[model samples]
Target: MKLDSAGLQVLSPAECVELLASTPIGRVVFTDHALPAVQPVNFVLDGTTVVMRTTPGSKLAVAARNTVVAFETDEFDPETGTGWSVTAIGYARAVTDPVETERLAHLSGAPWSPDGNDRFIVMPIRQVSGRRVRVRP
Candidate 1:
């Protein structure tokens, strides 16, 4: 990673994926009413894909299907002023196959806040980028 943008280091794709796997919670950015919407979700990294649960008839279930979305996660230290941020943009779709859903079930785990989470959605990470900011001591 090389420093850029005010002491920010650009992370490699592998590094970005590693950081994503380390975190359980992330935000999904999608479209709502033709406008942008963001929602926090608990997700798991299945290889290079992101799998999460959503309820039927929910905004996520409806809006996210067959669409492009941006997922992101980050960790920051105020005192040390050091942290990393990762962003992934890709196509999202609902898991329709029962067998595939069962396979993914082993990886997704339980949702953070359950609300009839009967639907499973998957997002294939198409483009990923990350940055780390390290403040001087």
Candidate 2:
């Protein structure tokens, strides 16, 4: 855990995970055709692992599997100049195991896409870093 009072406050690993899980949507960054790409995902945090569903033919399905990826979510207020951002970096893997997929499916909000939200991708949180700033007075 690290802290800075003036410019930004560095959050602990636990705080980062908690903040990451509090949000319902996040952006996932991965490689697409060797070029970097970022896709928004409706995700749920399951004990520090981020889970989301994607269609079989979608680029996310093909591009994110078995790769190191970045997941991020944040909120801010323009008037206050205060907010927090947390990022999680880890290796992603498709959850082909039926039991685990079924288990994670019950965690939270329904996926934004159709196709029954069947394809599950899991990113186990390896490293989390975040910063928070105070409101301007």
Candidate 3:
């Protein structure tokens, strides 16, 4: 297995994409008001693109538009001390086509919150990398 400098198992792009598809929630990092910000979002991977729903004109919707951002998701077991993290960096764009929006809405389902999150932001997985930590046997 490939290992990074820190001894963590280096994951391939396919592995990273698989991990990303397995998780429903992730953090999106973007620049907000000239400062870095991270927000947890409910997302689904449509192919290699990360699709997230947000209300129109929301902070994330506004700030992430046509900008490069990072999306990350991971899972860990406390007792085993084993985990894997996947991150995807790419440019984000708001889905504007009506047909595409309708298609994505079905895939996305309802928002995590009660608010109506009608806007869909799509980020194609341009660059992906991941690492896994496994406890010694």
In TM-score terms, which candidate is top?
3
lDDT of each: 0.86, 0.84, 0.89
lDDT, residue 74, candidate 2: 89
The best candidate by lDDT is 3
Per-residue lDDT over 1-137 for candidate 2, one digit per residue giving the tens place of the 0 to 100 score: 46766558898888889889888889999989889899998898889889977777789998999999999998788788889989999999998776666677666545333335578899999999899965654
Q: Name the regions of candidate 1 deviating beyond 4 angstroms.
A: 5-7, 111-116, 134-137
Please tell me which model should have the higher lDDT, number 1 or number 3.
Answer: 3
Question: Global CA lDDT of candidate 2, please?
Answer: 0.84
Stronger candidate by lDDT (1 vs 2):
1
The full ranking of all candidates by lDDT, starting with the best, is: 3, 1, 2
- Alpha carbon lDDT at 5, candidate 3: 98
Per-residue lDDT over 1-137 for candidate 3, one digit per residue giving the tens place of the 0 to 100 score = 99999999999999999999998999999999999999988899999999988778689888988999999998888888899999999999988776688788888885343244478899999999999977533
After best superposition, candidate 1 residue 112: deviation in angstroms?
14
What C-alpha RMSD separates each model from the true structure? 3.3, 3.4, 3.2
lDDT of 2 at 11: 85
Candidate 2 residues lying further than 4 Å off, grouped into runs, are 1-6, 109-117, 133-137
